[model samples]
Target chain A: MQSGDSLPELAPGDLPRQFTSRAALQQHLQQLFPSASGALSPIVGGWAAAQERLAAVDPGAYGRSRNHLAGAVTHLSPYIRHGVLGLAAVRDAVLGRITRRPEGEKLVNELGWRDYWQRLWGQLGDGIWDDQEPLKTGHPASSYASELPADIAGGSTGLACMDAFAAELRATGWLHNHARMWLAAYVVHWRRVRWQAGARWFLQHLLDGDPASNNLSWQWVASSFSHKPYLFNRANLERFGAGHHCQGCPAARRCPFDASYEALEQRLFAVTPTPRRR
Target chain B: MTAAPMTATPMNSPILWIHGAALGPANPALVAWPGRPAVFVFDDALIAGSALSLKRLGFLYECLLELPVTIRRGDVASEVLAFAARHQADGVVTTAAVDPRFRQLGQAIAARVPLTVLPVEPFVAPEAGGPQPGDLGRFSRYWRRAEPLVWQRFKG
Candidate 1:
């Protein structure tokens, strides 16, 4: 379906009979956007290439390079998120390529995690969106008078990593899965912005912005998901983001915490002692 | 921001109610405790409350004279804790959905105070027919395909 077009009305029977494989789907997609051949061709071609890569590559490579922020990581999240690539199809492809190998076991576990998150979403239902800010009760984050919207969407954040990520999201409507975690953490913990704000920004921009993944991921970084909060330190920034690109990072001098990263992290993590249950 | 008026004496223990749905039989958990400072933890979908399910919830809330509660939207565990802390809530109540992450969070919160998990079945309006076998199959297929990448976890 073309972007911005209304979903075509379909009766239950009108839906496609059998699920189409990602490769077959990509071939059909190419026909829809033939004019932009060179620019789009590789994305279609990349699906095939990724399938091949999954066959021969080790799962360790995924863990290692997933955080590079540049394009080295597998860009499969968006495809999977949008249902452009089916999870079972991808799993089957990966499994077919590495059956009985140690890598296959590792990859299958990773797949299982996705299911786990989804199950969590189903289990929790709407409780997942409840507000959990400390000190401030019921004060929604100010969407107005905030640079967050422009910074995230317009790529004007000035932090090299943040800016690059924002730009990449806008340009390609995709971010590597690891980068998404980093960005969400930065926005919620380091930047001291509200998780809802970041969530809204992602929903507006990400092509694969599933409600479960985007909302849950933001909650995880905000320390809202777990009792202990997670903070991304300068050491982490330097390690994963070796490229040193953004010159305008608000946290440049202070690195991770001068930007209030630790406090933000602690805010989400520190759990007040609950009274003993009867 | 203006401070909320202190009408009644603060309860010795306050319950933080985290709701995942926008509407239905379970919504009373959110709207019932009026005047007691409770936090309403919800997600974009429920806040959007555009779905048929949630619309019913809004109507329910409107009909009830809710206790003093704070409405906040977020993912499950974090939102519940944040709401509890922000509101100085002594406990939490939520529906039983199978989010291990939220369950873990609930367990941790329970250690601190009371975390009550309410098992709620989706209340489809009577007029709405249940999903046919085919519809269930389509949804199942969609989930199976989306499961791997969407649900993959890191083994550290």
Candidate 2:
């Protein structure tokens, strides 16, 4: 992985003309990264290494291992998020190397989701804010803000998975795609924290923090953007994070759902229904 | 030269407000004002173009039409002074700006009119409740059973 310090700052003259296409952008990148070593040595080095690893590996393994908290999945989000690697370029490179299959299509769909969110942002400038429901009127026992600092930054939340996520997000500025969904669901449905607070916390810490994806994804889990809400159980946590060694999760016994490892494995690995906009 | 006596003013002129975000969520309180001034929202194309989003520039032009009370987009203070001189406006009311230039504009406008910068809280999403074991199993089953139908709809 490339460290933030290793990347060189480009002058105005170095930038490409506006409205450059993906192919043209790639050509520009090639010129920019001319030799094996350049000012962008870190980016080039990271991209080359990632591409090599991606080419040789079986992405099917990703479907099974993507949820594990350990180093079980590829970390391509940062590279893609920063515009260091264009989506089209990555797609072309991946397609060239791997046979197009259901698993590959799923990965591609994930990338397409990123594109969808950006386009949606362009379509709705502030409507995203407009659709927001006001915090329940009349004083509730607690406000979302009260729990935000501890659950997000302090990582003092009693939920084992939630605390682990907070710690990891603070440490690395990244989280697995699935883990993000799980975290958002747990926070909104289980912890009852407001989505906006969670979104802001994510943005403050995430290196790949994007307004469209982060905001909309939070909305989706909160059931604000969709008709139905998403909820997770303790078993779901155990299956995905067995190796992480979490401590004192609140959901262990108090949870409404079963926490059995085998039950969770069957549920998570099953050919499940894809998420949809309600 | 002898100055003509100024006549007492009639009712306060309504102030038209323009913004890029949705008025309801961004500024709910504004909706309650009795003035109920006309609102002109710029299209996305106008807001997204150039250094300043088209929406912002459109807002500037819209404010110009309501000169005197016209709330200028940049350097609120100067814009207010300029509008006051040109249109003889009663006063300017405007929302706060994040950009330094706009913030300055607010200060400038405040010099002339009764500018109010309303404070607001941002919206947030709620957390998920931990589901029961049977509910978890049901949700999983529901997800699996619905996959084919959802995919078909997606493809369509």
Candidate 3:
């Protein structure tokens, strides 16, 4: 397993820059940073990898189907998060491909979201950790648990979709944006855990764990940064998820998410309907 | 005679300090000095505080490996300063970092050696000779100002 050359020994207090394989690299990192738990992600990170993903962007399809589980989404967040691929470069690539403005508008607008998060981070500094706005949900902040429960963390939530999302996060260090929103909503709204606890849990595992994006999005789901907590019913999940999690799942008999948004909102929020606009 | 714009010439053996924010070849500092001695320090505080998984760390290491930077982990300021002294460099050159922690480290390194913060290419640069983009309170407001600017670069 010659990666490039034989893996080099660590210099005095300096980390080794060479490895024979991804496994070797993972093992070396396991030894080097013991506090960092979990295995290597299937997603390789480098300029070449980022460019390869960039080359495959289908702007027309991406704009149309990006919200679905099996959508034509660009798996570029991890690389983009770390600045392995710059935002402008990605934008230019998208713009270069489209014949019509509408084709690339959605993808470019998504890039704008990334830029927006960074700008907020610059403005807020560490204040991104705090709630940007008070929760519109009737429940008080003290009602949420301060830590992520072990069942959720261990992927034993008895709900197939959430457990699978947790497994994917722990194993791969990445999740589709929909999965993140769904899993985060479950943690905060259904489980009554603090968004900060869930945010910290995500930061521990997400490859794209930029505090600006992760925390703010968590705050969005928690109704601290948005007008209302983002919610999804079983039909919404089953529709977009392509019936992946519900066919033979243990939770199928009595799924927690098995209700309409209206019903779920009434049950979870206990307040009047949350305002839809900012 | 017409006034000429100044070019950013390389300094006296300034060490190219690469941070997580600017690891790619497109980094302004890297663009200024392509192959000069460069170092990337994995800040200890950031790792332990976030409890960063090996997955992310490995990703970063692989990215740095693709570049010509020495990989080091410790107190970021100390390691960067040590790397600068090791090269007998007159200064440190880095692209600006958004994170406050890195800005503090840049200050420490600058206190010891001349440090230059180069401008990165923004996703949407401010209007030429106009007031800065305003009202970042929401994405819609910001995009109303930025979306037009972003598409102005498109030739298609």
Estimate TM-scores for all models: 0.46, 0.47, 0.93
> Among all windows of ten consecutive residues in candidate 3 chain A, which has the lowest summed lDDT?
A1-10
TM-score of 1: 0.46
- Cα lDDT of model 3 by residue, B21-96, tens digit: 7767687877788667788898889899888888889888888777767789999899999988888887888877
Chain A vs. native, model 2, TM-score = 0.66
Write candidate 1's Cα lDDT for B1-156 as tens digits: 011111223345566453332222223344345344444443444334322122222222221112233444345456567656755776665544343444555666666556655443221111223322233222344344443333242232
Off by over 4 Å in 1: A1-60, A70-72, A99-101, A131-149, A246-251, A254-278, B1-156
Error of 1 at A75 (Å): 1.8
Q: Where in model 2 is the C-alpha error above 4 Å? A: A1-57, A67-72, A130-151, A243-278, B1-156
Docking quality level of the chain pair in candidate 1: incorrect
lDDT comparing candidate 1 with the true structure: 0.46
Candidate 1, residue A13: the lDDT equals 18
Off by over 4 Å in 3: A1-11, A275-278, B1-10, B128-134
Which lDDT value does model 1 have at A180?
77
What ranking of all candidate models by TM-score puts the best one first? 3, 2, 1
Best by TM-score: 3
Provide the lowest-lDDT 10-residue window in model 2 chain A: A36-45
Model 2 chain B lowest lDDT segment of ten? B122-131
